[model samples]
Target: MTTRRRAAPDATRRSEESRRAILAAAFDLVGQVGYARLSIEGIAARAGVGKQTIYRWWPSKGAVLFDAFLMLSEGETGRPALPDTGDLEADLKAVLRSTVAELNDPRYDEPMRALNTEILHDPALAAAYAERLDGPLKEAKKERLRSAQRAGELRADLDLDVAVEMVWGPLLNRWLQRSGPLTPHYADSIVETALNGLRRPTRRRRDQH
Candidate 1:
């Protein structure tokens, strides 16, 4: 008698479907309940799958949430496409402005808040969250900066990586901390402050008082 391989093509398809289901379920639940309150059973019920199915794929609630949020925010274009209109500053501003709108949307708020609270309670989880969301965003923003550099639109002396992080860090800091409701105006300020740069590399880093 011949035995069939366990991981056949149909098995692969089913696995992918199940994984997608789990991700969708996790996102939905996180939107409904804080990540702290979210549970494997909850995700399983939402996904219409057995708890064992989730456990078979993900090790922890944090893992499921991280993956779910990543998939929700990311897409086929890679990091949501940074509006490359050959005008780097305008492109960055437009994307950031839209991102501010996204952050301010009620549906998006809780999952983001959940992610933020997790970061505060668990540094490891925070690192993982940053790796998933912030890191890719930072890289994509940097790539847009690099495009600007190639086009000679930005000062050659500017460090593209530092500029990207500066632009990203402040705006994200606001959203994740709930320091204030995110705004397009804030996004514009970030772009302006970063692009115009502080102290103009001269008057002293802090002498602009």
Candidate 2:
């Protein structure tokens, strides 16, 4: 009988390092050159890997950029959860303000704009984006809403899916369309308005005769 040996731990670490390098290169290059000028050759050259290596892992430049954006969003801690400090309004405002800051940042602005452009045109990439990035983040948001619901902070019957969109959609649209400044004040207004609509309506008292 013959026994097969597992791959060495060093090999796995090297693979992980290479993957991170490729992702980082794609992220930085897109910011520098914009998405239209970004290519696998450039990414590979920047990453210190062969073009074939990138092709082996990703189907297209759009796909590479998508993963790169995902890695950047995840940071060193994998996926992030929405803040839940037991005060839904304050927590949501904090999250939205942070988002506004990122969107306004020069390092993130170009890369995110490029990712949004790709998602608009590529159906396959859009689907993957929804599945891998949007879906998880949306669910995390819904969970926070669910907590608010449990705490009676929101209407028990409130539709969480719509609620999430209501809070986030305006910020995204404003940024993408360049319609307005993405400031902390704008983020706070969004949270306040959305929460007002989502909360249980107050009953009016009868007028005195």
Candidate 3:
């Protein structure tokens, strides 16, 4: 009897390769041509796959773009965690500065703006964004805050969800609305202002007043 090997693994590998190619094509095309002009046909042509391939995996262009961005983020740094260097204020400043840099980067700026716009109108994409991208990042931020709480750097009673929002919301709003420049100075100011409200007051400081 001749032994026959299963081709399942090979097929799976090919499928995964195709998926990655599609995602990369979508990302590259969006960065090259703004989201307004991105199309399934363009992505399929660039990826060297049929239009049905993209549709089989993703429902719409927004879903493809979201996944493409998610893939880029994961490839860059596998679900980022906030730095907890024991000094909550300094750590937050560093993270915020990094965030400001990313927001200002041309490669990321347009794609991110497009994704945010999609989220507003596409409920399904919004849910997936929350679950896959935003949710994990928020939880990581909250964990850093919890560490600060445990170290007595932050108020024990501080609501972490609210605190996370307070630290990040303004910057997000500014970026989305184009109200102000996302500069390192703005990032530092945000950290300083948020820390003032969130930090546990010291007894010596209180005695001075």
- TM-scores of the models, in the given order? 0.81, 0.87, 0.87
Q: State the displacement of the C-alpha of residue 132, model 2, in Å, after optimal TM-score superposition.
A: 1.1
Q: Between candidates 1 and 2, name the one with more favorable TM-score.
A: 2
RMSD values for the candidates in order, in angstroms, are 5.3, 4.6, 5.5
Model 1 ranges off by over 4 Å: 1-6, 78-80, 116-133, 198-209
In model 3, the Cα lDDT at residue 96 comes to 94
The superposed Cα distance between candidate 3 and the true structure at residue 191, in angstroms, equals: 0.6
Model 2, which residues run further than 4 Å from truth? 1-8, 73-79, 198-209
- Looking at model 3, which ten-residue stretch has the lowest summed lDDT? 1-10
Judged by lDDT against the true structure, how good is candidate 2?
Answer: 0.88
Task: Tell me the tens digit of each residue's lDDT in model 1 across 12-107.
Answer: 798778888998888888887877789999999988999998887788887787787777776555554477899877888898898798888767
Clashing pairs in 2: none
What is the lDDT for 52 in model 1?
95
- Residue 19 of model 2 has an lDDT of 84
Off by over 4 Å in 3: 1-7, 76-79, 198-209
| Pairs clashing within candidate 3 | none
